[model samples]
Target: MKTLYIDCFCGAAGDMLLGALIEAGADYEAISKALNSLGVDGYTLSCEKVNKHGTMATKFDVHVDDAHDHPHRHLRHIVEIIEAGDLPKEVKEASLETFRRIAECEAEVHGTTIERVHFHEVGAVDSIVDIVGVHLALHQLQPERIVSSALHVGSGTVKCAHGVMPVPAPATVLLLRGVPSYSGDVDGELVTPTGAALVAQVADEFGPMPHMRINTVGVGSGTKDLPDRPNVLRVMWGDAVGDFHTKESITVIEANIDDMNPELLPPLLEDLLESGARDAFITPILGKKGRPAHLITVLADDKKVSAVTDTLLRGSSTLGVRMRKEQRICLERDWKHVLTPWGDVRVKIGTYKGTTSTTSPEYEDCARVAREGGVTTREVYESAYAAAIKGEYKDA
Candidate 1:
């Protein structure tokens, strides 16, 4: 699968994302033409390479002519502008959703209803261009998945239309709910409202850089240069290259239990699996005094680690559970049905790259067919394997 990882060490803005995407191979002319079709007046878009500290990056600017007197618009006005544009349907919907979220945030911040909210800076021509251009660029790139790093929301107060407020303005604060963010070393508004909204809308997951083969790296410069670090956002376009599988980080929880009944272990395992454990098993171990103990181990995704741990603690006689992280690779798998003389057996096909590496017939299907045919399960399995090898499966 294709992946795009956004490195927001300096935080992200809409213009920065657009610039980085364009540099990462999104067609600039397509983005420009799409924006021009909107027929919004009094603004011009330009992109150029610039140096920030020592790293060269693209600077995307939307120069708006204030002399044209663009009016402060409401949420409905912005929605109308985006709806009238000739762009991708998904792009229009995403842009509209972004504006709606901002309107909601603003409404909450100012104690007004969404309909009564008046957008000041966000309704301006530059912000509109930045937001629309970003969606256009992302659509052009067409990555299968998009990931981002934790945002570095800078410290210190920022002066806005609402007067001096905290580092992340009220609207930005409201927009970045549930997203991983921190007060960065540089003191300024690192993440803008438009940037925060885009991140919330587009990023599929947030953490460290994912395990992807980096193909192209594009850097976008921020407006201000920071003291200790380069103020730039990086867009990495790459394929999720793997040996035989994709990689992900998982948590392993283990507990030593000698007091619990071995007969109850199966039920405890069932509960753990039901509670979101990827895998659960027990191992025989010698305790400190040579007593035989069962080591209960569970593999879980990060989000489900707590639940798995709770199940281990509550369902077993273990006082505490120890946890650790592990990196695991999973083969891409799909189901195909292979026809046998008795019945159809579903087979799991595991692939690496484009080549099939392994195949396994559904044991339950084989067993059922074996009973009906008065044959051994081994014989049914053999027939299924032969059918699979003979390409008896209907679908790929």
Candidate 2:
């Protein structure tokens, strides 16, 4: 499968992302044609090769007429603009989703509803084009999976519509809540709201670039030319290397508790899982006092360990939780929809060594179909599995 990895060494912006994709071989003329269809006047996109700190890169620029001063727009207005634009269905949806998230974050930061929230810098014509252009570019690439590295957010102060604000302004901070980030020696905002929203919207996972055979690489230049650092974003496209099927290392946390109430266990587990625990389970155990205890275990990525541990401590009466790193070997997995007598069920197919080794129907999908068809989940699972074995649905 093809994958796209974003290296946010100097952080990412919507224009940078779109520019890198175009440089990596997305059709520039097609993107230009689509933008022209938007019908908004007084703005044009310019793409060119530039050298940044000794590295050649593509610089995307949105030139707007000085006569047209853009006013801040509300969420609904932005949505209407996107809806009226002539963009492909997938591109339209992705772009709208990115904008919606930014609006929601702004609303939350100001304690207002999405309808009442007004766009600040993000509502400008340049930012709008950047985001929409990014969506169209991503549609052309059609990567199977998207990953990113830890974001580099610069420190110090920044001037905004709301006056001077600290680096990683309120909305930017809200957008980057769960993503790994750091602010350092750089004396200005490295990640903008548009940039943060784009990354948070599309990134499937954030960490180091995994093992892969790189097919193409593109460097996207940012507007600000810092003296100490290259203001650029790197995009890499490739296939996974080696067996590629081997799962990366993940952190697993386990805790044994005999003193906590059995009734309290369910909610604690739910909280942990909801807070990003990959999986949580309990196993019966005997404590020092010969009392039966529950062994609670949580599997999660490295970034989620702290949050999951916090939830456990706050929700349960545990003195300590044991943590360890372990390797999990997972068969390459993908999803497919299968038609059964009841309804459509989503099936998960796991491939090992390039052959289907296991097939299972998603329980939630089965439950939903069973509820609508007035049957049991078991019946749905069975029907879906049987259909898969019979080649009713092909691999996704």
Candidate 3:
């Protein structure tokens, strides 16, 4: 599997992330042309080689005309600006969701609604370019997995549009909630609000670099060099170095519900899956006072745990959910299409050490084909299995 690892030993910012992506193989000219159409004006994008301490890195820049005249934009305004241009659906949606994440954090910090909370630094043309550029670059790279090292959020006080605040400003702190991060020895604001949102929301898991055959290493320079460190963000792009099985840390959320109507459980499960949950199920249980209850168990990527937790709390009778980190081993899985007598059936094939270990025909596909062909699902399944056997499916 193709993977991208973010090394935040120094820190991360929107520009830094974009710079890393560009240096890692994202097309800069394409990103520039896309930004030119982003509807927000008065900004020209540029990238150049910069020396961060003794090492060289790419520095992404956005030169905004009349920087003082830029408006403090609200969430709606920023959305309009992003929506005004032609962009890939994935990039556009991801970019919008990122802004929403930031806006939500800002609203929480300032005690205001997301719609009413106006962005100060984040609203500027330059920051807008940085966010959009980062998304565009990711779209271009199309990595199957994005992992980040624990963020090194610098220490000490820093001044921002919100006045003097501690390192990791209020919005930054709120954004980094539940994310693995630590304050480094540097005394300054290393992770900006945009940086925190980008990394926290984008990375599926936070830890040291996973096992991978290293490819290109892109170093992105910060605004200024630090005396102790190189002050650069490194992006490692490579293929997963696995023994056909991979290990990952997942967040498991569980809650016991006895008060909510039983009919609501299915839809809640569906909602959880739609909101980034990997698996969501309910099991029957006898609760306090011997009341019949359903135990809701949710599994999700570390990045999606917060949304899954919210869904569990607000979408069900459970007042709160318990979360725990658990490591899981997964086989290398891929899909194969089998031509059944009734119709085509999709088969999920799991492999280990380059050997096919298991195959499961998609029940929904088999059932649909059976229904269309006026046959039993069992017959369809058998025929699908026979066809797959003849094809001798191989690992993807």
Candidate 4:
């Protein structure tokens, strides 16, 4: 599968993401054409090759005309602007999703609703172009999946429209609720609200750069001078290996809790998943005091080990947790559509040793079909499986 890995050692902003995409082979002319089609004039986009520290990178900038003075815009206004644009549906939706996420997080941080939230810096013409142009560029690359490194949020306070606030800013912190992040070796706001929103909305997974063959590298420079590191974001585009079999390392974190309320367990599991745990479960156990207790375990990547551990400790009534590294083998999997008698069902096909090893209809698909056809979900599953076995679908 086509994959893009974002190395955010210097954190990400919308323009930085755009620059990286262009440097990684996305067409600049195509992006400009799409932005023009938006009909939101008064901004000029440009990129130039620059050297940061010792690494060459692309620096992207959007110069907006001072005459165009739409400083603050509501969520509806931004949505209308995006919807009226003539860009591709994917570009429009992706851009809208990014803006919407920012609006939601801003509203939550400021004690308002999405409808009432006002986007200040995010609503500027330059930022609008940066956000929309990013989606346009990403559409051209067409990576099947995107992964990112933990964000370096930077330290120190930042002065913004909302007055002086801690580093990462309130909106940025809200957007990065579930994502893994850290304060890097810098004393400035490394991550802007726009940058945090872009990654929070677009990234499919967050962890270390996965195992893959190198294809191309793109470096985007940030407009800053740091004492300890170069201000740049690196993105790598590559193809994940074939053959369907893969092995990777993961961390298993476990804790025993007997005092936490049982009612809170469900939300704890959900929180763990949202916090990037591959899996989380609870097992009944007997504690040292002979009291019935629960053992909670979470499986996650090494990058997420610290964040997941913190979540377990805070969300549950546990003072400490145990963790260990383990390896897991998994088959490469893809979805296939099977035409059943009642409806079309999605079947998961797992490949191992370059051969198809397992086929199963997605339970959610089966259940939906069963509900519509007035039959048992098992019937839908059996029919879909039979269809797969009979090669009823072309892909099957």
Give per-model TM-scores: 0.65, 0.64, 0.69, 0.64
Clashes of 4: 0
Per-residue lDDT tens digits of candidate 3, residues 282-370?
A: 99999998999999999987656766787788899888888898988877666789887677889877777667778888899999999
What TM-score does candidate 4 reach? 0.64
Ranked by TM-score, the better of candidates 3 and 4 is: 3
lDDT of 3 at 68: 46
lDDT of 2 by residue, 51-152 (tens): 888778899999988798677789888888888888876677678778887988989988999998888789888888899988888888877567899899
User: What would the per-residue lDDT of candidate 1 be over residues 236-345, giving only the tens digit for each residue?
Assistant: 99876565227667789999998888999999999999776889999999999899999999997654575677788889898898889888776656678988888889
Best by TM-score: 3
Positional deviation of residue 372's Cα in model 4 after best superposition, in angstroms: 39
lDDT of 1 at 21: 89
> Which pairs of residues collide in candidate 1?
none
- lDDT for model 1 comes to 0.85
Backbone N/Cα/C clashes per model: 0, 0, 0, 0
Residues 77-152 of candidate 4 have per-residue lDDT tens digits of: 8888888888876577668778878988888898989999888889888888889988888878877668899999
**Residue 29 displacement (Å), model 3:** 1.5
Query: Could you list the CA RMSD of all candidates, in the order they appear?
Result: 12.1, 9.9, 5.7, 10.3
